[model samples]
Target: MDNEGVFVTKRSIKWLATLALSASLPAAASTCGDQGVWLQVLGSGGPEVGDQRASSSYLIWHNGKARILVDFGSGALLRFEEAQAKIEDLSAVAFTHFHVDHSGDFPALVKASFFSPRTAPLPVLGPSGNHLLPSTEQFVTRLFNESSGVWPYLSDHLSGNGAYPLIPHELASNSTQPTTVWEGVSAKLSGVGVNHGPLPAIAWRADIGGKSIVFSGDMSGRSGTLEKLAQHADLLVAHNAVPESARGVARRLHMPPSVIGTIANAASVTEVVISHRMLRTLERKEETERFIRDSYKGLVHFANDLNCFAVP
Candidate 1:
């Protein structure tokens, strides 16, 4: 049977009915509400911008303090500012990969750091480098080093006299399993490898104040890596770039709705937030939700720009 036909099957129909009923209720705000650990969707769109979803960036707040900024994609800086996010409050920045759509805004963010009064060097984390792709350390250095790069204005600030500094940290390529890459402010950042061409991809799992949330950074389908890292997370933010009907091209770099559902089901995450929507998925939101609901029995939410999810 074709994918569309399967979605209309009795089981899927019942699931959709349940989803319709559940959608009427207010969604859970957060996993740690009193502790103030919350998630803000800076940009919900993918590489393409149709409905103004801002690529794939998220801001995580711990105890009303900005603990981490995850994946600063293109135009994310604008979205962050629009959301009233404090760039200086960030303890660390974690990049899932070096894709233009995901990490393109890093240089701009670094330049903006100069205007802030940050005394400590900002820690930036990402995968190890290869000949083609720069490691997290090299990526940051190339941007601010005195020799060459785009932001020469940052040279003085990066050097002496209480300038804004960036401390680069590279996550070992293909680490055996998920491990802590950065930890502070009652939060821990850990990651697992994901398939996104030869560029190398990663997914982050953060534990903030005893609550956990996972972000799947553009994986190739529903792999065990995602399930293992996201296992039992309070919220699993999965990418929904293509519909189940999409094939070939999308299967290589992105996951369809069904794939996301299966992974969320396997991980047993309490809630599944669909993000990174491309032009196609943005126009067909209901279709994507129905496709995912067919296999996954959990709360499925379609995230939008600036939408905040409060952690319990």
Candidate 2:
């Protein structure tokens, strides 16, 4: 069956029913149990040092374990440590794009994992490359390629000589359809290509514990792939990097509040979490919320570092 049909299936119908029933209850704060699913923001800000917020990063907690890491941006290592997350516990590492603000701390996590007892190959998924950006595999190789990588000392990760092997999966950067990146007993991940100017990018979706959450990553909302992927999702973590008045390159690279609201409303997501907050957007919180509310009337939240949202 087609991807769109997957959402209207009997199982998804029941899932939506559950969300509707739970709509009246408030989502618990920073609480997720062994039987529940939760999303934690490791870094909610963009590439601005003055904001005192980390770059784009997130963690998916399922069955009391940090099963999926969305991105390991700058300063995310400290946040990971503060959250008490173990790199050994992650089922996979998924990257939306290779921007510094989105993937600066990857080596840190790999080095940290060297101290863990894990020996299983780690799956790293990202978008395919273009002339402007490296593919996921190329990006990993450039990090520890033994002969030419900046950190040749850590080449053991690429070679089999390290604690574990690094497995890289590069999804098509132009495909509008969702591509499955990882799947386990209870956790499944998929990504769809998104427009981030010349940079290849993806928007990810995770289904675990019968709940769904979609991460918009950093997209301009020109491809419309995110809406299809986020259809009926329990929650959407979208970037609020630009304000409504933004134009030129800034407007082309990031989606403003209006686009985010339209996508959230179109996807029928239960709630929306506005993250990847930049100083420009943060300064106009009231105006941003007003623009988002013009089209989406559901629960809206402004994210912060270490803030957790239970997937209801």
Indicate the residue-level lDDT of 169 in model 2. 85
RMSD (CA, Å), each prediction: 4.4, 7.8
Clashing pairs in 1: 29-310, 30-310, 30-311, 30-312, 31-311, 31-312, 32-311, 32-312, 33-312, 45-53
**lDDT of each model, Cα atoms only?**
0.75, 0.86
Per-residue lDDT tens digits for candidate 2, residues 1-312, read 000101112544553543454355454354445658888899999889898898999999987898999988999999988888888888899999999999999998888887899888899989999888899999999999999998888999999999899999889989899888889888889999999988999999999989999999999999999999999999999999999998999989989999999999999999888889888877776677667766986777778888888887
- Runs in model 1 lying further than 4 Å from the true structure: 1-13, 27-35, 156-162
The per-candidate count of clashes, in order, stands at 10, 0
Backbone clashes (count) for model 2: 0
List model 1 lDDT by residue over 1-312, tens digit each: 001111233645585566465656464332223356788778787787456767789888777666788899988999878766677788888988887788888788877766777777677888887877888877876777777856766766457544556777777656647878888757788987777656567789889878898999887753468888888999898887777787676778788888888888888898877788788776776678677776787767777777778654
TM-score of each: 0.88, 0.90
lDDT of 1 at 39: 83
